[model samples]
Target: MTKERIEKILKAGANVVLTTKGIDDMALKYFVEAGAIAVRRVRKEDMRHIAKATGATMVSTFADMEGEETYDSSFLGH
Candidate 1:
């Protein structure tokens, strides 16, 4: 929920962020500021379809999410 983290995520050149929950105001602002689209509340089936179509990696964990001291670049969907 940190801007710096969100900024880092967008900086990885993601086309969009597909989530299982609706996006909130803070996240929307961050995505807009970083020039990325945020697609929220996507169904798992659709997420799979999009992943197959785009060849983007899906991250199941924030253990490696952006901007944490333990952040790992591989968590990014690019």
Candidate 2:
């Protein structure tokens, strides 16, 4: 992801991020700088399991975060 995208996620209060895609080195660095954990290349099934276990909603993009049906920082798991 781009630096600005990562910044918005952090600013929205996510401390742990899980994704089924690769995370760029710069984005990883940004996560470290913010004291957050970013785990990439996770399997989709595993992601589903995590979400079910944590009561966290999965969203694909920053734009998807817009509305009640979508997710905000409050939808994130601890």
Best-matching candidate per lDDT: 2
- The sequence of per-residue lDDT tens digits that candidate 1 reaches over residues 1-78 is 567657666666664788777778898888887778888889988988887787666766555345444334554544
TM-score of each: 0.73, 0.83
lDDT of 2 by residue, 41-62 (tens): 9999999999999888787766
Q: What is the Å distance of residue 74 in model 1 from its true position?
A: 5.5
lDDT of 2 at 42: 98
Indicate the worst ten consecutive residues by lDDT in candidate 2. Answer: 63-72
The regions of model 1 sitting more than 4 angstroms off are 65-78
RMSD of 2: 3.2
Minimal lDDT window, size 10, model 1: 64-73
lDDT of 1 at 36: 81
